[model samples]
Target: MQGDYQVISTLLPLENPDHLEARGIHVVRTDVTKDVSVKELKDFLQKFTGGRLDILINNAGICYTMPATDTEIPNVEKMFAVNVFGPMRVVRFLHLMLIEAKGVVVNIGSIGGICPFVYGSSYNASKAALHHYGNTLRVEMRPFGVRVVNVISGEVSTNILKSDHGRSLPQGKWSSTADPAPMGHTDTRAESVFYPLNEEFQKHVHRTPNAITPNQYAEGVVKEIVKRAPAAWFWFGASSTSIRMVDVFLPRTTWDWLFGRMFNLRKLADGLPSQIKL
Candidate 1:
């Protein structure tokens, strides 16, 4: 998009646009939760491209650290609105334009969606639903020659850390996604998150290794989009393959066992806790 194509990006209204505009990317203010946003995007694309679109990327997402037991219902709703509904709106409204250009729809999902987590039900559930939706879209849009590629991303070194639990968030416009709730000071402290399960996982995340940078992840995604025939599911980033294998071959309790060993949750329960198995 930097040199070859004109990139029109959407961000929250409060997000700064000057820097992105400086990079020659047209920035559109959009709140995916709103019904009008889809119409606005359609109009913009129509006026910009004469009703032909090459690619549609649904990248607007938000994550918060909390267990289902302690999470407020509205907060979960907000996560769904961003992660699931926002992308759904864009794809639904823009499908025609994509068909016109034989385009591709790229959805950025998470390994968290596939691999079970004791403490991430809200965020995890939203992503899992999204993964399923992308699969469904792929089958539905096949005849139209519109490719739906679900990028099941591993944890990348992105502002997601700050968005999930606001520690060390960079000042100015560093992230496309808005911080969900000022980070809630997410940290290794037991009080960092509400549920004990999530608190331990949050602590472990602080020390977890092998996360790739956002640029590397972006490079992989670009490579996928340019493929003549892209895979319906593509994965990359350090530790992603391991997690995907665990999700596919291991029982649900094994992932819980992992959570226990990583965060010392097992010590409190003698062995790997059975109660947290999903």
Candidate 2:
């Protein structure tokens, strides 16, 4: 980070670019979801970093919360585009620099991929795909001296969630998750069977109110990346360790029951008719 540092994102950091420029860090406005922007980034890096990149972090991601059946096709496609394909596109264009420098590729994944958190079906699937991609990429890149590290991240204080009005919540603040808010971009359809769970769905969106600060998560990730032999998958961030332990030790039925209770699924089940027409 001390030498030749640059950050690329679809959206620039909120802070004045001057602040980062003052410290010799340049921000490039690039979109990973587009191949043209990714190629442009590669071109910029070729000139800026002298065709050598020591580290590449695929941190661009987006999330939406809703029942899987209720999730629109476009929403699912968009999430996969940004969260899964975005990383793959970036790596495809930039892997040469990473290979030249014997560098590391870090994919910021989520624990939601491992745990069946209600209302995060598509978001979870995207992360699961990313986690698998990183693991396989590691094997493929190893021959070229490139290291791929996948971070099974947990909750962090970031504006990853948007309000029903399409405004991002506050960054690094608990206020973002303090009150339940409707997560769906559209209003719940009255005809949908899941309409009765609207309140619970909103609550699930704001479930992780006490998330770790971004700085805290970053510090741990940096440490892992700098290690001489970092593990293939590193776990860090709020509740990450606990969730990993639960996944490792708990039975599938226990996990199902726990998540059901956590997300109000039990109540919904209790209200349903015991005899099924099907």
lDDT tens digits, residue span 1-278, model 1: 57566788998889999978998999888888888977897898899989998888899998866555345567688889999999998887889999999999999998888876656778889999999999999999999999999989888877665665532212232222334333333322222122334444556446444689878988899888878898889987777799888878988789777876765664444422343333
Best by lDDT: 2
Top-TM-score candidate index: 2
TM-score of each: 0.81, 0.84
| Model 2 stretches astray by more than 4 angstroms | 1-24, 163-190, 206-208, 270-278
Q: How far is candidate 2 from the true structure (C-alpha RMSD, Å)?
A: 7.4
Instruction: Give candidate 1 misplaced runs (Cα > 4 Å).
Output: 1-3, 166-209, 270-278
Query: lDDT tens digits, residues 97-213, model 2?
Result: 999999999999999989988777889999999999999999999999899899999899887875332322222212211333245444322223354566666565655557899
Q: State each model's C-alpha RMSD to the native.
A: 8.3, 7.4
